[model samples]
Each structure stands twice: as structure tokens, then as C-alpha cells.
Target: VRPGESTQDEPNQKWETEDWGIFSSKVRYAAEKQLDTAPLSQAITQLAISFVGTTYTPGTLEV
Candidate 1:
């Protein structure tokens, strides 16, 4: 995973909340939503490509 830049030292420190419980819950919710949306996002991309159809014709490509 790409690491985000920190504006201060101890970058591992939670910036979300004073309570650990709240911070962890928010992280979990965000991660789950991203996971759920990933497949649909990929599907939409594939559908768009299918709609565009093949860009190359057979025998047109050569070594």
C-alpha cells in the first residue's frame, strides 16, 4: 500500500479520534465500503470496454 505523507512526527499515530474505539470503527467502515465498491467499479470498467468493442481487427496485427 502507498503510504500517506504526515505533517508531523509519529506518523503512525491515529489522527481520527481521541478514542481508539471510534478511530478503529471509522477505519473499518471505510475499508469495507472500498472493498464492496471495488468489484462493481471493475465491472463497470469491463462493461464500458465491451461496449467499445474490439479495437483491432484479426490479421491486421503482425510481427
Candidate 2:
């Protein structure tokens, strides 16, 4: 959004909180949630399962 602002390749600069521009939050949120009363492994497993019905299109990432 400015002149001479080179499109530099860097980590967590432009999109520090986005995952594929969908849900946005830091990893600490998941870490803390997992570290709660539930075991981290279980939390991770359930979290992975939670996205079962979420929309996803093949080849989108291929571009």
C-alpha cells in the first residue's frame, strides 16, 4: 500500500494470525486449550476431527 515497499518474503509479517486466510489466531490458543483439563494429545485429535465437514477444494493449493 505504498511506494518502494518491496514485497519482501518474511514470516508472520503480513498474516501473522491467518491460516489460509480462514480462522485467525495464534498457536498459543490451541496450545493453551490443549493444556487444559484435557490431555494435549486428545485435544489435538479432537481438534483435528472437528474440521471433518469444513469446506475444502482440491487443486486450490496446487496453484
Q: How close is every model to the real structure, measured as TM-score?
A: 0.27, 0.37
Off by over 4 Å in 2: 1-13, 16-35, 58-63
Residue pairs in collision within model 2: none
Cα deviation of 27 in candidate 1 (Å)?
0.1
* Candidate 1 per-residue lDDT over residues 1-63, each given as its tens digit: 123433355555433333455446555655655544568777556444543644656863342
TM-score of 1: 0.27
lDDT of 1 at 33: 52
lDDT of each: 0.50, 0.52
lDDT of 2 by residue, 1-63 (tens): 133233356322343223523443324556556645577788777667656787888854441
